[model samples]
Target: MKLELGDQSGRTAIITGANSGLGAQTATALADAGADVVLACRNTDKAAAVANRIGAKARVEKLDLADLQSVRDFADRIDGANLLINNAGVMALPLRRTADGFEMQFGTNHLGHFALTLLMLDKVSDRVVTLSSGMHSLGRLDFDDLNWENRRYRRWRAYGDSKLANLMFAKELARRLEASESSLVSVAAHPGYASTDLQGHTESLMDVVMAVGNSVAAQSAADGAMPTLYAATSPAVRTGGFYGPTKFGGMRGAPGPSSYREVADDEAQRTRLWQASEELVGITSPV
Candidate 1:
């Protein structure tokens, strides 16, 4: 990825999950480029530390995507954001429910960010960058059972579904923006394999696999943050564009356009996902 960053002075950005990992690195880089970076996080203590390191141009706000109320409250408290970076998410884990009683990964990763983006729509001006994953290639959205309410939960599949939703949301939002003649363009990015704390919580065979992969091929968190930065700030990013590392099976290298699953190409399904998201989140967002 290009390490060179263009000037983004006077722009304000809200980066979810900015407490650590790729989010934190992205926040730091944006701040260094003179953008006001808001570290939206569930953990204010960690966020505060990151903000301090980011110098005077940084601020911290509490944002828990897993809770609709939390997302609403966070949106209301902020204003004048030129960018909304949907960088927070969860990965494979045992079956669990969020505060809203939806599957944990689906709730926090897709629905949570889905609701947050709409609530934040009016506040953003330039663009919104939603983070997906390389694993989205394996995802299939079960629209009939979005929460896995009628099916057995598979942790990896749940994670894949959420990531796929991220791409779908990005594309759908781009379409809406175009239809409404809005200035906002929705883009997606993947960090590839990055070594971060997100890997420390796995307690299954997948944990060992993640450990081995990171040790052998993963880049540092700073390197991982580049594709997100590119999507958020690069002039080359187009509406519905997806960016990721381009070498080693997209696990590491320069940030560039990356391939998405054919599953993400269905516009009808994107519309359905949008409708389902609005109903699930209890809000009718303006296009």
Candidate 2:
């Protein structure tokens, strides 16, 4: 199936973590659809390579999602983005903290995107697509211990929590956009079990686990990216919707509604998350 990004010609899109994996694929697809793509990444060289591969109209920028200031800097540099793809994220990395001292996974995977989204909200007039995960179903937000400083830190659990936060943020953003009657739309998609370098963060887990998952369950990065592309481009897409692979336990196949957690749809929790996110990021949403 092919994607038609209608009216995308000459439009600009900012894709975080566009240097590799699913983000890179999305960048390519958007470029192919005639959108001018900006590759926001920590590694400028890697991002530049992807931009070059995608050809002209694709440019690279330096961005560190773990630093709020960096996110602000990146936001300040751009104006009028038709699409914002919050695709940059870290996986099961060792316990650490962001530049602001929050748990690294939570800070980078959720809070950073939170800050960036708010900072760029006014400029993002069309849509915002966050990369979420199936692991979010196993996650439950920890309001009391968001940092994991006073609690035990299991890598996967922290990753799961962050992914859940990503979905929650998208859902909440959509609600706010609707309430304000803004043109912006918010949606989310997961890559399911896409094979990518993100596994390097979990090297301690064992190659057999990674290999089996990649071979039996994982889709190619391009294949996994289709859902996000769909959410970003499809006319049938609805705000606050979640999309992912439709095959075996959501491990592969075409774009469709993926199973989401009840907690993710909790309005009270989402509201609290919005407030906490605003306080943490110190950026107010336009809504």
Give each model a TM-score.
Answer: 0.97, 0.96
Which pairs clash (backbone N, Cα, C closer than 3 Å) in model 1? 1-254
lDDT for model 1: 0.91
- How well is each residue in 66-150 modelled by candidate 2, as lDDT tens digits? 8888988988888768899999999888888998888998999899999988888888879999999999976777788888988
Clashes of 1: 1
C-alpha lDDT of residue 276 in model 2: 85
Please list all clashing residue pairs in model 2, or write none if there are none.
Answer: none
Predict model 2's lDDT versus the native: 0.88
lDDT (tens digit, per residue) of candidate 1 on 121-145 = 9888999999999988778889899
Evaluated at residue 125, the lDDT of candidate 2 is 74
Model 2 RMSD to the real structure? 1.4
